[model samples]
Target: MWDPVTDAYVASSDSGAPPNGERFMLYALSQRTGLPSLPLTSIGYVDLIDSSAGAVGVTLVGTPATGPPATYARYCVARGTASVTSLVGFVTDGTTRLELRVRTDSTAPGTLSVQTAIAVAGRDVQLSEAVTVSPAGGDTARMTTDLRVTSGGETVRATGDVTVDTTTRIGSGRMTVSVNDGAFATLTLGGPDLVVAAEAGVTLTTADETTLRALFSTSFELFGTVRVLFTPVPLSRASPPVDERALVSPEES
Candidate 1:
């Protein structure tokens, strides 16, 4: 079963006795009733169990049914030693689907990296970010991000490094953005609001302007200080980290 609110898998079952035949089943708990469950729509399935196989193999896939069909898709499961080290998922706003990838930093114990890509509607955007939690105290962390957006044969890129106080949920940093490798526009953070300023003689093409507007509309609040559009999840209220290595095998890991 799956919990829509938490977006987590709760339970699973297999029926019909293994040796003879069996069928795998997936379910989701109804939010309205919270008693009876609902079966997930299975768009695809793969069977890896085989008696003739030379080695034991396992493949697991997850399909989330809570969100809009066009906006959500199944994720691939990566095997880890003690937990899931890597994850791949898809999210969309109907017009475009963004590919989201997340993984723990093997070299850095308490660090995480998130990458996102969007290639649609003549636009290609990619973002790579690294977030590291302070080992001395979990109340603080650092995030470094790089973003690139391309459209109509033009390209724009931005890079930022910020320190965040997990306890206060406040971040301070400066992001520098450039269009077509031209002069950069800087956005400063950590003050009352985000502040943006461009270098002298910075110019933009018609296509570049359109792309920037679309990006700002979807990702930032530009009225005063710029703020990213996101739903904040406080670390204090967040679930404990799961060791992804345990979820996968040695070969997969």
Candidate 2:
């Protein structure tokens, strides 16, 4: 029958000749336009075959994926006269997230995965490196990036990470040190020094249980609690001490 009011085809048969509804039109459009339609994982209306007594036809399921990427064919499960829903599912690398909703007539809740593609901003760099520079001959050394240091003390007193991308590089380019008398340790400069320094002859106790005796410099941010562990040492105390003929911050503080 024709829906004179809407000017579209109306239900002229009993419960609409077999599968004759919007689905029929959509399916026809897909066939004619060669456009793919949604796929159902499974299709099963509440029927007498598998349904117990008092059950009504109301379900459509797509074939489950053997492992992943389960393809769903477009279909519907009618409870009785009017109840339809849609569902889609797929998987992709964690670079992305997916979410899908499958509608239904029943009150029970159901969930289905929807998204399949994901991407991240950067390459997501995850790496660790340590470059130690012990300035010699009274010269400063610089680094290309920030640094992570573990000052020595019982059971290694300090451990921290920092990014040193600074223009004012360290004066000392690089050198090699005996790592706790174990082996030759190469120390190179990284970003703006993620600087660890001391006065001409100040000492710092490090985690390696070694008191870097003030043989050449003081502890790098060695005075206070280890809370300020990673970033640049707080300048308040690190600034040049109040001494005769000296500014708060030395020319190179």
Candidate 3:
């Protein structure tokens, strides 16, 4: 039994909530339409190729390499292009360039752009650069960071960490991918190259909404903060959707 008042899982036999040590499934509406909204038996987050995180954007702000403010602030952030919130770390020598992995939406191919800014305490600076990259639907692209300033050379490397009060916030959101179930099959995606530590119920945001939205729309399962499950659920694990056509090439057919 579920007590909407208490907002927790409970046993039908007992009036109280399930014991801490005891295990139970929480129920929720299935994201997949046509199917009854039941306890989501499977849940997981959106996984980007090569990296653990989804699409992300970063901005680099700095001061003149000469005086007043000599250090540069590297804003490691998420979203298509938004204000800097958290600081991953800092580097000096006038942040010359930065590399970022941007994810591509399903319908928007070959169209990817990210913005970065650099502020010089007492000088003017140019902060937008464009680079071309090739990425598949629901994939990632490595972008080059561009920054220019008056007086000093256009290129600068990190010298040291910048002293700034910033919190590290990981982006989280609901996502779903499908996979084939023929007895049992294993799928490997570029191996686990990127690592972002998180747990259930953590709110997240995606840098590339197009890709993730399309994915969840067709996905049989979903990854969310709360694992809503039906009273009776399956014990099998959830996996990304599989494509039979991709398995066999034109030559094979």
Candidate 4:
């Protein structure tokens, strides 16, 4: 059983204080919720973490030795487009659904954009860039990432020039996609020779948001090279909720 008075995962000690191991575990789990480990020092100072850690507007401040500061000495930090505590889970917008992305683009607040059949909202995220979004319900998000986006709670990365095309639908879980080098090559899109890596469980859903356009919804490992005919089309939700449709034409002009 858990003890509230002692705050231990198990029973409290005779001294009423938790063991060193218990304290470490409790502190670590708390970090996942945007909570700081605090003034982890030998000194008596205790740092209190705030709740708005992953948001883009949080800030901090520090007291300089030269300045009088306030009545007492203190340190502070300012939030600079702060990102999420971790790279797992989902971002729901009530009725809609979306995913988060990371990129290596030079553009700030422009590298990332929300994509859908109707409209999108963009953000600037880069390599190793972590973020969090609380949708009104269950909205979908298209993203850009340089890290190998993994599956099953952002664990393993699927290496390749990844694309959540007109027929893509990530399931309800923590799906991570990290772009590890050399695993993928280029593709001459629109050409019959073009091919894509189809991992297990990774489904390509249609614009209707109900149709199963393409099936390969799992973890796609790189066996060969995938070239890029056009620039890497970062995933986005646009006019049709989905694009990059495959077309069939007549033989005769």
Best by TM-score: 1
Residue 181, model 2, lDDT: 34
Give me the runs in candidate 2 sitting further than 4 Å from their true place.
1-167, 190-253
Model 1: per-residue Cα lDDT over 34-70, one tens digit each: 6335444453222233333221122223444564323
lDDT at position 121, candidate 4 = 23
For model 3, how does the per-residue alpha-carbon lDDT over 1-253 read when each residue is reduced to its tens digit?
Answer: 4445555545556332223222232344346553324443322111111112422222223223345533332323222222211212223345453222222121233322222232433444432222222232342222222222223434321111111111211111222222121111111112222122222443334533343333222121211100111101111122212221221111100
Clashes of 2: 50
| Rank ordering of all candidates by lDDT, starting from the highest | 1, 3, 2, 4
Between candidates 1 and 4, which one is better according to TM-score?
A: 1
Stretches of candidate 3 off by over 4 Å are 1-76, 80-91, 94-111, 135-253
List, residue by residue over 58-153, the lDDT tens digit for candidate 2: 222222235433222222211222322222222223343322222222111221111111122243322112212211222232222222222332
Question: Model 1 — which ten-residue stretch has the worst lDDT?
Answer: 223-232
TM-score of 3: 0.19
Index of the highest-lDDT prediction: 1
In candidate 1, position 97 carries an lDDT of 65
